[model samples]
Target: MNAPNIRPDIRFVWLNVHGGTFHKLIRLHERLRDSGLSCEVLFSVGPPRGLKLGVDVPLERVPELAARGVHFLGRTEVLNRAEKSPARLTVTDAHHDPDLPRLVRGLRARGHITAQMATLLGDFCHHGAEHLLMQHPLTLFFEMDYNHTPEGRGFAQAKTIQFTGNIFFEPTANRLVNDYPDREAFCARYGFDPARPLCLWLPNSCDARSETYGQVIEAVRGAGANLVVKLHPWEYAFKKHGGEHPWGLAATTDVLWSVQAVDETDGTWAYRFCDVAMVRGSATILELPFLEKPCVMLPLKEHVALFRAQANLVRTCCAALSDMRDLPPLLKNGPPAYSPQDYEAGRKSVRIDTTRDAYEQTMDALRQILSAPEELPVFGSLAPLRRMADPFVDASLIRTLTPSRRLRYLAARALRGICG
Candidate 1:
């Protein structure tokens, strides 16, 4: 069934593309609903597939998500570029959401984009629309990080509220931060161990970013490490014998097809196993030190302020990188403020109330935005998506796994003769 219409009095929640970032939004939605407020969500079917993209309906499970009285809107279907767009292999456009212009215009008129979606939302507070941002700490990422905040306003369009990293990405607690390998373990796992240091290259798999692949690939091949190009798991799927669509790579620098992926390509895990992790982001960079690895970053220029605003714990943890190459000239600018002392405190630390606190923060910000007569957010709200959500891992393999009854995680520790 089509999602219900947005109530006239409801606040409009604008989000960019939807994928892993939804982790926090999902949590907040449930909380907001219980409190009796409603919101609207905007997304495209598969990561902005439009010549210009608009909104998309999520999978059954996503809509079924208990977003606290939230209603999804702007659902439209476009070509699945991963398969349908033959022209997609070369030059492509991430601006397919043709409705985006309309969406932006509508949001601005509604007054939500002024604060929550667009950092500009702050400029529109008098209109009464509220934006809820689902932020992650991918220091270099665009869709879901600080680039949408006050600092990035000079360049990045303000359509979403800015939140911190951990909230968007949930990291595994330390299993003893192991050495991020630079050898063939990543290669051997995927069958390409020609024996160069393993250099893991993670790309922004969005179609909007296809134009930069050449630049990225050049950096990957030029870097002295073995090139293990791990495509974001969001858009593409790896295939072996014509199976396993939407999968990615191992630590090795080969594009070998696979029937299964460990969901392990996540930079947090790769940071522990790879020699030098190449990212266009701070998400992995922020978490790299726990594994004691260095990073090669792509300079996007929008993450600086967020770095300053992040909790000191996030800053302290990342300064340990072996080297910070990639944008040498830009080094004069410096990274966000993350203190090393705060690292130990945030790492492997779990706050059961973190989720609800984040939710209340977001809602409170929305309310503040509604009540404010000013344009910019006079005060930053809680970093809703920065806290890691609850996760269940398979004890036997130590791989992060979703909760389940069939695989039996609840009692498996006992089954293995280990006490929980």
Candidate 2:
């Protein structure tokens, strides 16, 4: 089979070999290739293998990625050819995946230009400042809007962060305004009636309060509202660890199970028809106003302090039900009048603007990055040497040699102790 005959000027490199994240990048690569660009995807290995996270599992979709004309390379392969490689640009969906910064640092050390396509719309609560501040210089960030969020500011401290809007929401504006799915069909598919109020509840997996999924579903159902529950991908991982919470069950016919189907249609299919939405801390809240749906932030006690900390920003857009019992009362009056100011504020906090075409902006940014001169890789103020050596230490060669999972665990612990 011939290579996709990609243009030499633009080469896309996707990192962090995982489930849906890898697939998302593959679709983007295909979209770019069809537009006459050279693209190859490299998956992360080495230290990622030593880690115990379920997202760190072996690459499962290489055949699919290959069929899309993406060249798949492991981290070791990338390192071996770095001294003589010709791909002037590298693109990734993850900047904070633990193994990624190290590999990115290596690629930059060899003078390859790097860029990150944010997986989320700058959901600030999910990441730490170091995830941004520690990357190499000259790395470009194609975020929604860099000036609005702390992550963007942190990236600005060390890299060229662009306000390209988020590519994830590029199709959102169209969906919300003109291309929304037919309400009757959506209702029938989810066992909901078009005339009845349908509530969509999204819960994150990080909190034990997630176990409240069952309670939340029951509450909404008892309130004379039909429900659609979408569980975070990590929630399944949680159940594997013996978190036999009720939300783990495959939802029944009455409730819509829209997990991982966001890309199957226009991403906002769930939000398009729902009368009201509920969220704990998921980024899906960012889409509520655009879809003209009112959202209520369920007051999960555990996340109350976080809400209080960012209350000014969060409450501006949605009603915060101080108690779960208030669900009926809040929805009794129908969806609240959405505040344009609140919506814009929420968008800024997450670095999203539905009006802008982020996909085109991102491609333009990549082209511009390719034309620029490479900057020397910068070291952190502290532990420059150790930080420089981190990629190799976490590289696949070291972890692959460990004979067993227990040994790998001990080796990782020992490495941390020594480095500290």
Q: Which candidate should be chosen as best, given lDDT against the real structure?
A: 2
Model 2: lDDT of residue 58: 28
Residue lDDT tens for model 1, 1-420: 244333422333332433223334445444555566554433333222211111122244444532433333333422121112121011111122344344434445533333333221111111222333433222212322222333322222332333422333344321211223543444455554545555556654321234344544454445433455555533332221123333233432223331122232233444445555555533444445444444445444333333222322233443332223543322223333445545444443322233344456556655554454545542232222221111212122122222353244335434444421
Q: 184 in model 2: Cα distance from truth in Å?
A: 3.0
- The true-versus-predicted C-alpha distance at residue 265 of model 2, in Å, is 7.9
Q: How far is 85's C-alpha from truth in model 2 (Å)?
A: 6.3
**Local accuracy by lDDT, each model:** 0.36, 0.48
**For each candidate, C-alpha RMSD in Å?**
18.4, 12.3
Residue 93, candidate 1: Cα error in Å is 18
Worst 10 contiguous positions by lDDT, candidate 1: 85-94
List, residue by residue over 231-321, the lDDT tens digit for candidate 2: 5544432333334443555542123332222322223566666777888766556545445567787775554433343333445677876
Error of 1 at 312 (Å): 13
The TM-score values for the models, in the order shown, are 0.41, 0.60
Clashing pairs in 2: 46-396, 144-165
